[model samples]
Target: MSDFRSQLQEKLGLSSVDYHSNLSKEALFQEALTYDKGRIREGGPDDEHKAYQTRLGVQGPLVFYTDPSCTGRPVKDTFAAAWPEFEDKIWWKPDFQKYDPEAYLGLRKRVVEHLNAKNARLYVQEVYCGVDPEYAIPVRFVGEYASHALFTHNMFPKDVEGVRDEDEKRWTILNVPSFHCEPERDGSKSERAVILDFKDKVVLICGRADYCGVNKKSMFTVFNYLLPEQQELSMHCSANVGKQNDCAILFGLSGTGKTTLSADPNRRLIGDDEHAWTKDGVFNLEDGCYAKLIDLNKEAEPVIAAALSMPGTLIENVPALPGKPLEETDPQDLDLTDRSITENTRFSYPLSANPNVMPGARGPHPQTIVLLTADAFGVLPPVSILTRREVMYHFVSGFTSKLAGTEVGITEPVAAFSACFGAPFMAHFPSVYAKLLAEKMEAHHTRCILLNTGWSGGPYGTGKRISIKHTRALLDAALRGDFDEGNVEYEKHPIFGLLMPKSCEGVPSEILNPRNTWEDKDAYDRQALKLKEMFHENFAKKGFGAFGIEDVMA
Candidate 1:
């Protein structure tokens, strides 16, 4: 074992202390959170001696100071239980190592003071996990308002530990320690101590660090927790659910119209990215919407353009000024040059914050499941309705060409398969989610539609990429139930799958067929065969050939 592992084992009281002495910082963080509740409660110091007594009628809001280093291993562990293959890939990777914990804690103190001054109940929780299994420390702070706080720091390697046989395996320890301080009127020592408010019926996840690497994964964890108990609402690439009787789920990968199309002024948004469907109705997971921060122009997406700096919204890694000296200005521009670009985004107001959204909202069973694809090849029709088997086939195929620069070799139509539109965020195996989705769609009579928001004439950079405005127009028409009124015709293709040509008004007629999209017929055939071969190879490796998915592709 390494020195770091030894320190963690000694701190955590692990039985296999010698073996874990060399574990990474992240591993120690996970191991410490595995302690039993009794051990954690018995080992922490008492805060009652320094607790501040508040008057009965005082109107103070509850506040929590999360330990910046206290990694939320419970959440990570839960996700791992769902998809054991992704255990090592979870957690945040923000550049938190460069800054000092003391400095960050000081900033948090100021923020807490600012909030407490507004008559909010304030409490602080300090979180620590054992480096080993033996010594787990959990601390809580209870007082009028705690201004400063501190937490232990650790790091570890990124790797998956094991697979889970059932959903019940998802569990992790929660230990958050915080310092509480209330403002003094006469300059006497303001009461300072640790606080724990277990009765508040809330969980405060705090980190002083700027970013945690698990942006998408963390969002999934939050969604997994927020989902309704009985109903199963899985994540997919889709758009916001609007008010009125209208229900349209925009489906597409990143950079497609999923975000832009759903941000319509005409319709109220249910959620931008993820949502849950129960027997009751659909509920949004995030408190806000997360939009991609790319070459964003005000004219292209106006709603996103306006909500750039809304309060409680987070703007992720963007670039900075090239040569100008650093000066105080709009934080929006500073997003330029931020390295956290993979998850660079903006979260909208939480569903709980909006009164107009569903009251006492729970997950909703999907009424219509829309599968979105950005076919850079411009061969797919604008839209097509799918059968249950087709949905399963496409769900596994998850085909769409990567947009230029969005991926390394994104120009051609790349065969990408992500179960239920999000593989990383899934809590169970791909088949588990698929089976549930198929059963739900059958039970609820949910309709699944494939909408291609990509090019219509030639491959990207050759033929014009589908105009975002036109795509939005098509989406609006579909949501209004205009497409169902028309007699749309679909032709089943071998590799490209189903093609819908008659419904959309603006799309070209010839682009509906993959053969017509390319100038050279033979070359297109060769490339198409290559893509099919790639699909076959992937399917064989994943044990799909036996299931006949390989036969369908061939």
Candidate 2:
């Protein structure tokens, strides 16, 4: 342990610095409770400047807030310092721009100097990113906030072995929420920036990127690039194992019930959010779950709700229950409906919080691959059995929807197509991930399906979101291989040319085909056709069809 500590300090150039490295969760929790302005529940510091005060009698189940203006990810202020040594390997879009390595050097040097000047006590947590010994990489997290260290400790695996050359391959995260950037001086668009430097294997979190997601995702983005180099698939999905040890993987973007549906009481959870599919099997890149908590119904999601009382769990941004102070109220009574802080409220908890979880956060090759989508247009069938080619097509054209009021100007349902269901994090081209997925599917002989948990009768506001009971039933039937045999009747979707089952046990026959549920036949036809064209347009825009992926629907 001492040798590893020395290596970490030397690797991060922190030998002379007074920093705590690889402390226990309990120690970090105490540090955060005192140093990070941790509230008793939601009671913030009176002065805000007294953040450094060590308040005794620290009651836990603590809550913390980011900058009020930037409660969510600062997407605009994110950039990559792609070194000239490796050019064009990373996808450099406008939102994720390329930073000048020279500018980053000056900014980082000054930032470290500033931390030293303030005598800020840094927290370091060294951990692994994945559970699989072959694919997982060691990550040394050096940050200003103790909560970030605890977050990293909660979200990733520790004591992972067989990752050769841990020193050279490991990545470092230099997170300093205290240091705000000057746009002109720091070459940042705003006072804060989240910069990823591939050359140094470091992520710079200047400003209050106290959003715990930045801590987890900064490493995931790197894994997406590194894993594919070894022909492995890094996925943005949720996975779980069943009673008979049957494994299922659910793929989708935000608003899709990947996390919610995977934490089944009957099944054992493997992981939520990030995973890697390798030659051996599938393993969760993260050992913990970072689930959204906006309007969370405790009874409906018992697994997640039950995790609230666990010791290592951390809740972000959810306000205190109405009419009571946090010090007096139970954290489970948190006002999930209150979006006063931000709608993107979250909960970070380790897998131990879940009573039923796959050991080591590892599972076999998935028997069923579910492509989940929340189609706000209500045009997609509840469940569509996909052919192998269709799976390849839809995998790249990863489609979902944005309901009205989700963003600033989206007054109606808007079509959203993310390449591989995760464009921003996919460092390599979409084709890279698509090809790897194809290889895995062929080797494993996996069956794929598209399940819509969005709307039924009509579009959002007019129709209801699909019932969770029905969604779970459909998913259970899929995992059981009910559709594998041709016993259940299926009808061909006219507009999108998908194979929709006519009926299933526990699901209504009328709602199986989305058209029958709608009041107006002509309106349903128009909407379905519009959604079909949107898929084609997305395919063309992404140029996925040219990357050896056929336009199956077209």
Candidate 3:
């Protein structure tokens, strides 16, 4: 054990500790079920149990339940300690609260004291974040709960073959959810705080939020900060490989169809979220997929549906049927629509959950790069082919709507533009990643497509969400060169300037033009221009003048 480990052990006052360097799936499941951290719905005996035992049946599948109170990340309560070294590097947004070093140390002492008072045994799990040996980061997860450790096991890559035990670059996350902090003294906005110390490479997650995502993403924020130094472009995207080894990456913010679209049964899934495009190829930063489960239709999303029943998966904040005990609850009995717990209801399952997964979670150079946006304003075309410059423009713009109920107070879709599709996780300026993407796309001759999986015809209330079937059809067309087949005509979108295919084979020709489907052409024009203006304003604020970023003004 290092000095850091010794300090933690002494602070926690543990008589003995269970250090799982890398616990096996079965072992993790056993621990999760044993300590009351999570309840495993077992099979056999009764009808409910019987239903749980079966594979992907109507009753869904058995799941391990986590605490309802912490279904989603506490974004508001999180903070990043402003040490001298990386203070200037941070984006300093509302989400990234600045914590004074003195205050952070004071809070850490209090949190440690509280943990020592609990006298509880802690589970220390060792894991790796990246799949590529050269860029992979070793991580240590220390938590009071076993289920979180299980989550750590399921969500991160475990093959740390070349990483040495003495690797000093490992990030140590201390998750003590029971330790509440004083807002005034801790320099925290709330009682719960997730603080990242860049200089120390340590994360302190204390108080009310126990969502496992906090731990995982804390390291991701670090990666988003560090990877760029190595000239690697880290992205908030999903990736996959086709039969011909042709790779594709889907970039989108939360509530967009990045997860849904990338899980095509025909293609081998490389990863569901968080990836890096290096000189070699695309590599998944995470070993697992964290997917939203609201209104999940097994038939429509067979790949994601299949993962629900996988043994090692961890379901967060999904409610069970009224009278069903967690131990006997069938996944089908659980209400996917229930937001009583949270709309951010999610599950984390390993890449192995998808049968058709790329081994080593890596793929060749991307042949297609997709920008997925749920345009709630419903003015953008369903699909449009983009020039290389257009791709970079949209890439930096990262326009997507904030879906209803995804956040604590948001009850309806709201237009949002997160730079590079994931502003929160990004640690550097958007230009850094944009420049890298542009270089790689040009070098690989990759085709880029803008996919709108949001509303069509009108704005949110008046319009309807584009059918997944249609979106998939459009994606298939782009991937298979169907868009380029025969005599293809392009019409420029008046406001956004994207070239829409005049007609696609499977898609209805009339709807190809968004204006045609709108009941009021004038209203469509107004909404379209409004959204375009929002895009211009966002790009202007980014100040990418040096990168030649321009607004698509008519």
Q: Using lDDT, give the best candidate's number.
A: 2
Flag regions of model 3 displaced more than 4 Å: 1-21, 33-69, 116-119, 164-166, 402-413, 461-464, 482-487, 541-548
| Most accurate candidate by TM-score | 2
| Structural similarity to truth (TM-score) of each candidate | 0.58, 0.92, 0.87
Question: What lDDT tens digits, residue by residue, belong to model 3 across residues 265-287?
Answer: 78998988889898989998888
Model 1 lDDT on a 0 to 1 scale: 0.42
Q: What is the lDDT of candidate 3?
A: 0.76
Q: What is the C-alpha lDDT of each candidate?
A: 0.42, 0.81, 0.76
* Model 2 lDDT tens row, 1-554: 34655674464444445688888877777787577742222355422421211121133444656656556777788888968865578877665788888888888888877876776688888899999878888898888778788889989999997788787888888888778798899888888888887887888988856687887888889899899988789998888999888889999999888878887889998887898888878899987888788988888778778877666667777766677655566676677888887899888888777788888888999889999999999989999999878888888888999865755644599899888888888888888888888788889988899999999999997888999899989999999988775767888998889998877889989999999999999999999989999998888887776778999878
Q: What's the best-to-worst order under lDDT?
A: 2, 3, 1
lDDT of 1 by residue, 1-554 (tens): 12432332233222221122223323332332232011111234433221111111112101111222222222221212212333333322111011122332343344344433444332222222111111111222222212111111111101112323211222111122232333242111222211111112112223221122233334344344334223465565443455554555655666556766665666556666665555555654334444455556657655555555332233333333455322232444544334332334332222333333433223345566778878766556566667787776667666677754545644555556554566545543445555566777899767777777777556676766766656665666556555552456656775656545454566555554656767877766676567667656766655644444333545
**Candidate 3, residue 274: how far the Cα is off, in Å:** 1.1
